[model samples]
Target: MLSTSGTIIGIDSSTGACSIAVCRGGTMLAHFHEDMTRGQSERLAPMAEAGLAAAGLGFPDLDAIAVTRGPGSFTGLRIGMAFAKGLGQALGIPVFGVTGFDAVARAVFATEAAAGHGIAVILESRRADLFLQIYTTGGAPDGPPVALPPEDIAARLCQEGAAPLLLAGDAADKVLAVLDQASAAMLRSSLITAPDAREVALIGLEMAGDGDIPPALQPLYLRAPDVTAPRAG
Candidate 1:
């Protein structure tokens, strides 16, 4: 492992936001967050530059980079990954990839450690379905990520047993609405709406300390792109 004093940077543009964070050891040095479902490709670099400037660091000074590789918007994931990998390659530093699901789950796990119940990190797919994953209290995933219809979430959680469900990510409210009042009572809303770069920084720090290398930086897609070429007009 590099010196604990080295700085780590994390990025999240896997959904509607472009977020950048700089951290040292286990503490956040700086972060920039903004929501723009479009134009992430344009905003990412400037945001990274400004965030680092705010933190009084530069790209060359960066020790590692963490970017969310997701089961969210395809274009958004592509933009984020391209920028992060380019930066990491240029700086010759390790680029860590964190999943959107795990980012939210890990954040909630930190805040609600007493919740032996479990956390569901749901990413809104802008359809009747959602990109979802469940994490036990210890922060390890209970299962692999899957694309699930929002209507099925409540029943699916029930299938997992009676552990209280802590719902997080931007689509939490939709999942709650699908449940009956009694079942809804079993769910507790998490403070995070979407996974933020601040949490990503802390996560990167933990991975670094534990000497765990995250997955390779790439777009993690749950579904095919909505666009396709028209044939034979």
Candidate 2:
């Protein structure tokens, strides 16, 4: 089991970004990010090694590993999870899973301007739907994550009666057109486009402290997979 002050590493390759971070006692020691629409598998390992190197650590030094468990690119998620699990297995450390919403909410709460505001993390699917979740002002998630269309997302938040809502994720802008004047006024969007591995590390630290780590790492596929395997001979 990871101690409260244990060192943790977070990895996220679940979107356009491939990120890695090392954290100790809730503080991020080092992190690396590469922005690419694809090819995360090629970069994730070196990035992870670099982050560990930057932190003056090695795989065996980690007490736990955390990773964004999906609701983003299918290939990206698989690549990240595999790397994280491999590290955990090799180093004999625990591996935990985090959601995109958890990362976004942690990042939002990390901002001073977002203090005391509810949050809605909206990750866009390649299809017409979105992956959504809510967190209260203090960064505690309110409920389970769900999927909805852009219009329904706007309407649902309105029904939830969350005022001064802090919005993050790439598809946040799409929900704006469908929001009523009152709903729009009730919400405030942030600059975060997608979840970051640093935030994943931060939240992972908390989860480690609180002993809230997941039993297993699994992809949070809000929708069906976007890719189909090519026919083999």
- Using lDDT as the measure, which candidate wins? 2
Off by over 4 Å in 2: 211-214, 227-233
Q: In candidate 1, list every pair of residues with a backbone clash.
A: none
Task: Give per-residue CA lDDT, model 2, range 1-233, as digits (tens).
Answer: 46768999989999988999999986789989889989998998888888889999987888888899978998899999999889888887778898888888778777886887888899978788888998887777778888899988988788754656788888899898788787788788989889899988877777777766468888899778756799999
> lDDT value for candidate 1?
0.81
Task: Tell me the alpha-carbon RMSD of every candidate.
Answer: 1.9, 2.2
lDDT for each residue of candidate 1 in 1-233, tens digit (9 for 90 to 100): 76566699889988888899999987788988898879999899999999889998888889888888887888888888888899988988887778888788777777744367688888888887888898876777888888888888768876755567788889888888888898887778887768778777777766766666656766778887788788997
Clashes of each: 0, 0
Displacement of the residue 35 alpha carbon in candidate 2, Å: 0.6
Candidate 1: segments with Cα more than 4 A from true spot: 112-114, 212-215
> What is residue 124's positional error in candidate 1, in angstroms?
0.3
Model 2's lDDT to the true fold?
0.85
